[model samples]
Target chain A: MTRRKEKTELVPKEKQPISSQAGEPTRPGVFYSPAVDIFQTEEDLVIVADMPGVAPGDLNVDLEDSVLTVTGKVDEPDSDWKLRYREYGIGGYTRRFTLSDKIDQSGIEAKLVNGVLTVRLPKADALKPRKVLVKAA
Target chain B: MTVLRTHRFNDIWQEMNRWQQHMGDLFGERDYSKNACGVFPPINTYDNGESYIVLAEIPGISLDDLDITATATQLTLKGERSPNNDIADRSYHRAERDHGSFNRTIDLGQPIDPDKIDARFENGVLEIVLPRAAHALPRQITVKN
Candidate 1:
């Protein structure tokens, strides 16, 4: 028997649920529709995005005034159809997040390898754990 | 000696060469809009005794748009995704999907039995299975005293 997942997780259709009531909705030029998994280690935050059909040049990553945004676009394939069984339409992807002062914006990095977009944001010096040496009294 | 420290540093440095390259590329530019030029996905290859499997994630694409071709040593996937040309004059509250034309090609490291390849597409994922040549299989041997 063939088994399939009922529904894949999709980005929330509402752009910003919190900000919607505050003012007119922000028209985010680049929408990050890609599925991203965010993780943090002792020193940095890592964001892994699953952008299967997207290419390196097609990716746009921006860190501006404490906000991080990632955008991508993927094209469809060409095939002759006997009948329509399934449809996953083509659309652009957009994601945005407010940056924290503890992050080192200068050291943040992004890469597109193997259809995966990995963004690493290092923690700033002040945010890092420090060990103070005690002097003999 | 300083030479020893330099050598060790060089090993670590080279090990991180890809990381540095990627990091440099990441922070160098900031673009906020769609990219006019198109790019393709990278391919991965894995082999076992019976077959080799290739997997690619192709979201927001219809199965009809894809064209898969296999040769003795290569497998090619080509397709185009046309943007929503239908929607007009409505300001989108949010847009987070990518649409465009892309082609991905993977070179099977070893020669494969072209006639035995199998392919399946479902849920925006494409999988290609390539069987191994008969000679590539391992054979049993007897130990000598």
Candidate 2:
């Protein structure tokens, strides 16, 4: 999913708006909530978000007070093309998720590829399934 | 300065009708067909004076899984997505992403040079450049004084 550009100008028109037919202003200093899938296993919780047109270097992932935030800045393609129509807006992406106390924040790992961002959060030691010893009767 | 055509969904163009029909199959949102996509990769169309550029976003989809076809005035995209569950534990606590196949055809609203079309897929975004045909271009009228 692409970011939704606000109906304002984030970029100078330079006489470009005259050709726009998308019905919405797209200079897009706006940030959008990306579509995401969240899932968990016994050992780890994973999150995947769709942020097309965002490069890997433009992302920021930070954790504070057990809250995780992922932000991606989209680069407007440098071209002379004019917007004629659009099905999805274009801008940056930012979303946040709260991590449970059982999560090991330091062990979290994230990767972005083909415009998909995947984050893995490992479970704390206390939350892992453990084997118990029983005395033979 | 020449005023470029900026028509929205006000007029019913033949091309929009065919494109709307295809959109209705995957999304029954009626006129919203002129907008977003539910299961399909959302696309945007751009243009210069010479060609039409169609851009589609397909994150989490591998390039090898996509197939694109183009005509003189239309484009079709077909693809399948099977997300990689890279972790060891196969159990899923929650799943929101839908994975499967999608096929979409778009009417460009102008005849193009099908053979000269240039397509590039990078970073999960597919940009297709369809060059406008010679006859479809605006011809500058010369005055005979």
Candidate 3:
């Protein structure tokens, strides 16, 4: 009698968002959409976004109804030759964030230097870190 | 007098663009592309009772070409970058400078205290200070046990 091999089982995966021009879902690396890093501290949260090739004049940062949105565009640099290697290309970037009540929405701030966008969100008065004293019996 | 110089520079840059088209194609490597990786200047944010101070690094940009404005909650910066003229015919094995118009907007969560905001440009860096409204500051509280 010959031994028989058993078939392996396959798992079903969830559907993902597909690109408008292609039938397949978009992968993470192929395009550019600015990368953001957020750091939370006791007093505030700081967000840093990488938006190279963009000048301070072309960026738009807006905060409405506790939602923060950043929009900007970078024009293509002037050149006329065959491109052999490229790591960065000019493109548009837009991102939004819904803030929490603990934040002092009115006190949030943003700044752009070089090509980095920084946003600082301070905590509400009631949410700030405070030292509690123990009563002696 | 300051405005005239910048306007003239802008006219010249516009002419350069008109002389050529799709100049980016001349470069073979993408790293030297328009948006290639480069060290972005640091942004410093500071807060005082009345205002928030912001400083941005924008080297190679002339002060005359920059513009800064503030609204109740947003600060906008607009300016054009001109390529160095001294390097006339120097061919680049690699080029990373970004040339053209650029703008950056910053939102100070609090309403703009226009009367209190101060802006200045020096050495290619833009510094803006946004004052907080009296009512926008956090209030202190007393607790009883």
Task: Provide per-model DockQ scores.
Answer: 0.03, 0.28, 0.03
Candidates in descending TM-score order:
2, 1, 3
Docking class of 2: acceptable
- Root-mean-square deviation of every model: 22.8, 11.9, 25.8
i-RMS for every candidate: 15.9, 11.1, 23.4
Give the range of the ten consecutive residues with the poorest summed lDDT in model 2 chain A: A9-18
Local distance difference test, each candidate: 0.59, 0.75, 0.57
For model 3, residues B18-67, the per-residue Cα lDDT tens digits are 44434534653222323322323324455655567766545456668778
Q: For residues A48-111, what per-residue lDDT tens digits would candidate 2 score against the true structure?
A: 8877788889889999999998988877764788877767667787777888899988999999
TM-score of chain B of each: 0.64, 0.71, 0.59
TM-score of candidate 2 to 2 decimals: 0.72
**Pick by lDDT: 1 or 3, better one:** 1
Q: Is the docking of candidate 1 incorrect, acceptable, medium or high quality?
A: incorrect
| Candidate 2 per-residue lDDT over residues B13-51, each given as its tens digit | 866886777786668554433456353777878888999
What's the residue-level lDDT of B111 in candidate 2? 98
How much is the lDDT of residue A66 in candidate 3? 85
lDDT of 1 by residue, B16-109 (tens): 8756766756995322111212334323344545777765566445668778888888888887644333323323322344445666566676
